[model samples]
Target: MTDQPEPGGRPDAPRLTTREAAELLGVKPETVYAYVSRGQLGSVRAAGGRGSTFDADEVRALARRSGRREPSPAGGDLVFRTGGDLVFRTGITLIEQDRYYFRGVDATELARNHSYEEVAEWLWTGELRPGVRFTAPSETLAAARRTVGALPAHSGSTDRLRVAVTAAAATDPLRFDLSPGAVLSSARSLIPTLVGALPVLGPTEADGGSLARGLWPRLTARPADAPALAVLDAALALLIDHDLAASTLAARVAASARAHPYAVVSAGLGVLEGPLHGAASGLAHRMLQEAVDRGSAVPVVADHLRTGRPVPGLGHRLYRGEDPRARTLFALLEDVPQAAGALAAAREVVATTARHAPLHANIDLALAVLSVSCGMAAEAGETVFAVSRTAGWIAHALEEYGERPLRIRPSGQYTGPRPAQPLPHAP
Candidate 1:
């Protein structure tokens, strides 16, 4: 069989050193030798037979099958994996050395320098339109608002957003146009529509305003100061994409089946409701709020441990150090005078939790600080995440639509009872 060509379309790729192969496979060098011995891997003798070199593609394949590979350091390969065994080659986002990039540019830098709409446009297309703005069409916005208004009075923001997506899809005559241009159009509109459907808490901004400005009124009654708006916009851009998150994987799966851009977003929103994925910020918000209310983080931290709940917002599995998103947002939050009390509570919680295990604050905790300080509801972060991540879902859909249809369907490794056992009679 012909070897699948490398990512650059090269047939003769360079081999990997034993140490490099071991790093990719997440095993020790000795384990690499063991795999070679068991015929599970192939290696070539180095110049004097003093070392071994393995096929680069073979090592990567084993990493995928075993579903384990350590996060590469900065200056390493752009690709990294987490969340599951299935892997898709993507050019969208890369996280390495605790920093993430969008389309190969530093994401945090993009957030700092550009607007959310501008960064999202660059993610979908390589070109950056410096002053790009996304506006929801009146018809689509109307449809979404009608659907959202019909929801039960106590519906959370995510629930309303999900329902709004369906409504927006129905209003769009071209939603099934999955071509690149058409998908980008849908994405540009859908994001703003999702933001628009939420009930406004104060005087509304023009629908054509910057997305962060448009979103501010929906999230809270308090008027947004410039610093607070800066934090919100940065949060939106920072969250535009994280490679192959659970929601993003769901979006890719739908796109693999040729689902329209709206349907793809719906699939992602479906997965976003889970506590582990999107609700995490809401949990962190409540914790920070409690700590602020009680004037100390000690009892709040103790309460979580006493009740068998891990302290929220303290750790992230992906980052061994402080979460970069958290670090960036915390730095920005320092400029917001009103954020002082909640920001202090967040730092106290981190210091308190570090006594037992040294865990760094994740994005959820930073979002919690923003929400608690700004007087936004507990779920405001979720709303921000869902809206920002719609751009990522569309980016993934564009990639998936280019591949062979249904290519993402993985075969099940069935472990159930053997087939055709005698049927049991009714009990």
Candidate 2:
């Protein structure tokens, strides 16, 4: 019934019978049916008959297939293709999305209604109805604490997290197993470990909250946020997860290869450590700070774009519209009271750049400006990015656990002649 003739198009799309199509394409009638099932062609049932009819255009299109492709260079470009459907997914914190779906629950609503503990529990296990703040069995809190506590009290949170996670995985039996239960347990354990080690609230410190404040004795100058505990809680809640990203992809790749939590998570963090990705916001913020400090953000903003370097933090790759995370943080910024100047500079920066490039302040840029203006460290922003992406990494790792143990197989084009010529060597 889809055969509405293209206005003045080929004679009513000549309803060639399957047998006729086979003749036209130089194949058997069964081969014509094979093409239809393989999605290589289309067909419609003949009017008032059991036989299917083929549009002449589709038949001709099939006839044109020469089974040849462009000669692409040997190392194929990396691409993402949905591999297959999965049954179970687990233990991922999500990014600072406006509509963050944490394990299946809506994060924006949860961010407003539930506590971080509530969300963390939900992320670990699907039970959303709140009860106790505790996570599931084989609870690794004491073990994680002991491992981190052994480090010198002066260690930075990032350093501590790295060491702690590495140490925790060494003893965890689940890291070697590709089982979902084990991976899930490791994910649950690592979350607390990372959060526990962040820097204490204090001056010269960009990140501090109750979690951080608890470790303040390590820093020479501790900041005084009267409700230190609240900040930590907020940090836990604020950073948790995000969508699939390059770093997340790296993590997933490692997991798909059956790497342990430490190895897999490290793979992701290593990618995120790249300046072009995770460090983007902090770099942008610092760039803006230099401009502002020199009383030249306006001029620099204009000149930078002209010189080929677009203003950092104002544009995004996917969000052609305003970045939702930026909008949410903008709302959060309204209440911070002390971020007025940075907010003003950011506003001017955003307006100035829009005249040239299609960029919006993504989460990193927004968080950078707000955090810096609110007296956070420049490095703290990227650290938070790592924490947020951890959510998605775990989720992806869990998804991979159910699939066949795979080392991504690809066909390499034969470019080098069978074997290299033997060279005569005089030793």
Best by TM-score: 1
Model 2: runs farther than 4 Å from truth?
1-107, 129-160, 177-181, 198-239, 291-296, 410-420, 423-427
Query: What are the runs in model 1 whose C-alpha is more than 4 Å off?
Result: 1-84
Best by lDDT: 1
Residue-by-residue lDDT tens digits, candidate 1, 76-147 = 332344556556678999989999999999999999999999999999998999889998999999999999
CA RMSD of all predictions: 7.4, 10.9
lDDT of each: 0.88, 0.59
Least accurate stretch of 10 residues (summed lDDT) in model 2?
Answer: 78-87
TM-scores for every candidate against the unseen true structure? 0.82, 0.64
lDDT of 2: 0.59
Candidate 2 lDDT over residue span 1-427, tens digit each: 2323334336566678878788767678988778777766777766796788877766755564522121113423222122222112234544343345666666655644555555655665666645333231233445555677788867644555666667667667667876667776677657555655444454433332233333332322335443332333344455555655677767767876787767888888778777788778777778667665766568878778678876788766555666666665666566555566676777778787777666677766666665566455676667666665565566677765554445333334445755767975999
